[model samples]
Target chain A: MKTTETPAPPPAEPGASVSEVAAPVAGPPRRKKEGAVLNVFSHGVLVIWAIMVVTPLLWAVMTSFKDDSSIFGSPWALPDRLHFGNWARAWTEANMSGYFLNTVLVVGGSLIGTLVLGSMAAYVLARFDFPGNRFIYYLFIGGMSFPIMLALVPLFYVVNNMGLLNTIHGLILVYIAYSLPFTVFFLTAFFRTLPTSVAEAAFVDGASHTRTFFQIMLPMAKPGLISVGIFNFLGQWNQYMLPTVLNTDPDKKVLTQGLVQLAVSQGYKGDWSGLFAGLVMAMLPVLGAYIIFQRQVVQGLTAGALK
Target chain B: MQHGKYRFIVGFLAVPLGLYALFVVWPFIQSIYYSFTDWTGLSPEFKMVGFDNYKRMLHDDIFWKSLQHSLLFALVLPIVTISLALFFAFMINVGGRRRRGGPAITGVRGSSFYKIVYFFPQVLSIAIVALLFQFAYNPDSGAINSFLRGIGLGHVQPLWLGDPSLALWCVMAVLVWSTTGFFVVLFSAGMASIPGELYEAALIDGASRATTFFRITLPLLWDTVQSGWVYMGILALGAESFAVVQIMTTGPGGPDYSTTVLVLYVYQKAFRDGQAAYATTIGVALLVVTLAFAAIVMRLGRRERLEF
Candidate 1:
């Protein structure tokens, strides 16, 4: 893969000194002009990309509100009027509501389970000296690098053999299990960074290990939890591959899987508008959550990679 | 403090470890073993077939095709996505001209807005993004073709996901669109930590924009970039490719398995064709490719650390 490193542009003329220390008042007019051009070029490129990223999303939202004819006929046109009917139909008839509920139940159960189990494990791995600690820590973090699809084939059967297939709790358990890798990996590092004094003091104050964790350490680890929490929240919420394989029951499908199913079925039923509505409906919650929690979301997602 | 230390460790470790071992680790081991079996996945009874599945895979045309496509995804996606992200990130974090009373290095105007808007696609599920782009790529009445027509380029219309020749590119483009923002944000964070004094020094030496970037930004950001490459490459090979190819391409994998990736092929083989053993064989190959990809990138990217 070519990294595409460009040859550096020739250096500025030696005699033309425009460094801030050398010339505070004004750069050479030529330098000013060059800066103006580069500024426009950079901003222009950034703007175009921003547009490319936003346009399809806005199009999906617009198409969701349009009639079938308008949607098929004019791909770029705005809907003549807002069609609340599409949203209502999608919510009630297309089973978007059911899908949303399933997603919430699955993500909620899995997120809470992941954080509790993951942080508990991470705290111990970070703090205590114990036999097999290093081995166990590597074991959890090892899941972070391996391709999950490799495990998923047998995992499908594993879940099925346990009579857990196509069940909400089953999917929740699988989500938590899979999520533990990253959550543990991230929170382990995070837990290590935290001050050990308070937890030790809590332990000395006649608190049990569990009590210290629940009260002093857990609260102190709030920032780390929020970071990894948002990470798992988005991941479990948007999860498609896991549910697609394990939870095939129509009633149990999560939002992402449900939306794809709707698209497939809606194609034949000529419910394009409703499909788009469902798409938008499914898209809104995460996007909204992201916008509101933008900073944390970025931090949460990037934290693993940065480490 | 030491009274029940073992108990505390076991109590905390047991549940998560139990769940992970049962679901993640055990299945991983089982899949490797299953790769050698003659199990149909449809039936419980089966005998060890040794490397029969692996032997079949060597001759299997679709397996080869999927591997080729998967390799292509792993190679090309990271290059394109990382380049775009690095460019956007540089513009956002370091490409701006110095403004009055501002630090020597600063992002262009509205960089934060661009970062936010660019990240919109990353927040949405890949399946949802794939579905959106599938419509956009529709050859007949899709946004792309109609947009071409609007621009008076009606004579030139390409069947995006439908045309096998262009189908893979279309899917790759969707991935690039969805993922570039993530790396942009990631590299931005990397760049944010870089000291402004480096840029100031470069400027003092009469370094051009390109010079400062190649000399200062890229070297310092090398570690993040290397890791990001591996991360993106894995995504391209694994779940991300599965969603986009499965959801977007019709034929499901496309005009004639042109877009069939290893993950999709694995899903289809075990789930659709009942070739569970063979599916695991392919899964094993995928795991190998993934590891090899990570290892090679890391090896190639290893360089003397540029301490700030």
Candidate 2:
């Protein structure tokens, strides 16, 4: 994926040099000719994979527009007409609007909280040569391997004790805790990559650690921050397990759990179309984010995963 | 000045550290403590169980079966997903060559499209994924059987999620499909950073494509592969079975507990069966298994950092 971003091709070989190589036993010419054919075959394979991957999603969208009968009767056919109202009904009838708002609140609050807290911790870890810095960093990174399910029983206890069950705030707090490790790990790498000169300059001036982080370091780390935010947003938005186990009240449900309820209620009755519609509706926010933040999210996933 | 710097560092570190301690660390400690005590989730009445839960867990067949399922998932998932991802990533990476008057075939036909397509499952909620697959794997009118019947392989269609023997494999297939794209994107990026000259040099030396791939590509790509392996292993241990069990299967894992995984059993024991302490013991068992798997993978598969 990153290879596609390089615009300049490798410097072209001189024409005479290419022709000199081409004169030998039809070797160079044959290789060059075969290269073209190989490229074509490569594209063919990719195109086929793309079609296979996209078909299910296309089926989903098409099914969303069909009535219940047409969905099974003509699975591959286009909707007789685009029932735009399924989307509308999905929103209003399913109370997807409330779920959407809950998702945004949960994702947004978690994103902001994760970035602020995670970046601050990353800054201290990366910049200061403090005692136990490595230990603290390890502590955060170790949290990465701690299964949320391990904490599930205890998390319920803690949240229930705090009277946070079913509240968006409770979900937000859990999201923050769950998200912190990756965010800190990624941001620490990002901060370390920053030329030390910038932070050193800030230190030489009267800028305090907090001021340097917020003013100079944060702006410089925009790409990293944006990438991390998009990753966290996707994680929180598509989240199912946390919300399912945390918030039981339908009114407090996020899009994920709401879609589950919609499926359970509608699926057995052969309401596949409605279920698909709800699925499509639930996918919109992440789809929008993907379209907007495609490059950064890919970069973040690459960098964070590889590190 | 030294005292002031110490104060400043302490102040900067306090909030996040405090939250982590309270929410993450303290809970971990409390979980360990709770595993040894008898406490129902709802009521305050409790007793010191004194390793009773763990001792019972040792003899419980279900507990062992769940552990085996989780271990099986962790072992198999990375191998299947990573191999497929590597293949796809290589295809997409090398696929795009400039053709006459096209808008840079890379974006339209190359890694970007692969990125988006593969990431579709990642963006959808797991509930949606499970439900979608539930219909896809439906015994009577599901897409898989329909496609099989449409082709000449009409006799080969199996009840995917319905058959106990096939259900676990069916769930694993969905997991592989959903996650392989994520690894493909990651591996492709890792592949991209390798200098093009290296491949050219190998080609110039009369190395076949297979030789170049095995010798140059796989060795250099080991770090990304290991990272994906460890991460997937941890997730496999924790949530892979939990998510599918919660969504698609019945309690105690499904179809005579063929799909019962450790976390789900813990969930059932804690919430459904009202055996909180026993369930906590199951969770601790899982925690131990995950840590052990992670440690082994990290130690054995550790690769030197790629400079590029």
Candidate 3:
């Protein structure tokens, strides 16, 4: 307990990384030798993990360009020549283009819906004092812990009864509904943190409640919106179970569902190279997005867990 | 001002709340009610059959197997993943040598690079990860067996997903591989908030690396660790496990039902077998297990919160 509450040291060294600062405190010579050996061991383990993570992904890309026989012949070898044709075959012939478009449509509609609806509810819950306010808030949050599969069971029939089982719009509505729990949970907390001064001032100027939320509060909540947006975007984009059960239409299949279906059906056709091409094609966009937005992605994901 | 306040609040909450009720809350309530009935989900007309499904679940071999596997997943995946994550986080954040002119603590060289690469799998869908590993675990032309034969382990060949004994562990390994990085990144963030002075104080006291970690870092990071446990356990028992098992295994949960979990069992029974009511029975059991797992972790991990 004594060690835990030690005050942060004065910033005697200004340019050091946030992770560690050279505390301007010296240690005995014995610690130096131990540090030297520990550095090597740490690097060794980190390097091994990095290798383990990258090798399979790289192998998938390599196999995508190889011919069928070569993929089986030398799993680790470079392709004899680049086969951009395999990608073409996957894109057009394997209907990956269709799956990609369906995914975009579903995730796009649902993301926008989730953000709008989630923020409205979050704003009201955060700002207003109303009847059953706590009840409504916990109702949204309780959805987070219960098994979605349990809901999904009756959800299937409800969707069917509503004539929403296999349609893109139906899928979008369900996505928004399921996504509401976390979105509201996150943004309600975010809304409460915003200084009430701005919104209160706007209310004093006689801006209607709806107008104030749309113009004033929404723009102010941009950072929180972006964080939870990225979270839902990735989740809805990679979704498989919902589509597998609900949207079983071949033409409406999302990327993850389509690829798994392809692997299962491609066994008879022996289009291993095309299948591998399709697999890598589905991975590149999100992987590239993460590389570009690496920092925000980590913050968005970790923030939910930390809270 | 007071005239429209209630109306405004109701208008704001209406759509999201209504959608949540229709899709999420209503279904959850209906499933619990369905669990005691005899609805096949084919025609959806049925009568209540009290405790029949529960009674059958007790005697059913497949139900027991799935329950056992689900329990294993919830128990083993968190321990293995979190421990590995904790070690890597320590190495990356606090394991560097105390350089002569540098801070008293630093991560090893290239910490950022390792972090970036380790996080690659977390972005990709688990379905994609499962598929990639499925090919790699191929007995004949897959990478693992090929590497083994390449290294003169020519006489040794193991059917990874094909053999029942090895199949479950292989599936769990994929979950661990795909998930550990997220926790590593999570723990790294937790460690970053710890003041450098604490570590400096420990170093000045002649404490070894392991001693400082167990004594200082672990206690400070306890809350994050506990929450991470619940998060990972819920994931292990939920859709993530369902994706890997359905995609990678032989019968999609078989080599004689070796890798089938409660989620997979629920899926198979409801969708494939047309036993929706019975599926809800199993799903209710799963809900019980999931909540129990979380409650247990929270109870066991309870400790004095260390303010820093």
**Local distance difference test, each candidate:** 0.87, 0.76, 0.89
Tens-digit per-residue lDDT, B58-130, candidate 2: 9999999889888999999888888878777876764343344542223224366567778667666666777
Model 3: pairs clashing at backbone N, Cα or C within 3 Å? A21-B103, A22-B103, A22-B104, A23-B104
Q: DockQ of each model against the real complex?
A: 0.49, 0.34, 0.42
Question: Residue A281 of model 1: what lDDT?
Answer: 90
User: Model 2: per-residue lDDT, tens digit, A1-307?
Assistant: 1111122222332332243234334235655566545545454545555555566676777779988777776566689998877877778887788888988898889889989988888888887787899999999888888877767788788888999989999889888988888898998988998998887787788787677778999999998898888788777877887887889999999988888788777756666676788887776666677767777777766667877
Better of 1 and 2 by DockQ: 1
lDDT of 3 by residue, A1-307 (tens): 0111122332521223333333324555666556545655565656667767787898899999999999998898899999999999999999999999999999999999999999999999998998899999999998888888888888999999999989999999999998999999999999999998988788889998998899999999999999999999988988877888898888888899999999999899999999999999999999999999999999898888888
TM-score of chain A of each: 0.90, 0.84, 0.90
Report residue A228 deviation for candidate 2 (angstroms): 1.2
Give candidate 1 misplaced runs (Cα > 4 Å): A1-25, B304-308
- Provide interface RMSD per model, one decimal: 3.5, 5.3, 5.7
Residues B6-93, model 3: lDDT tens digits: 9899999889999999999999999999999999999958999999999999999999999999999999999999998999999889
Candidate 2 docks with a DockQ of: 0.34
The estimated TM-scores of all candidates read: 0.95, 0.88, 0.95
Task: State the displacement of the C-alpha of residue A236, model 2, in Å, after optimal TM-score superposition.
Answer: 0.9
Quick one: ranking by lDDT, best first? 3, 1, 2
RMSD after Cα superposition, model 3: 6.3
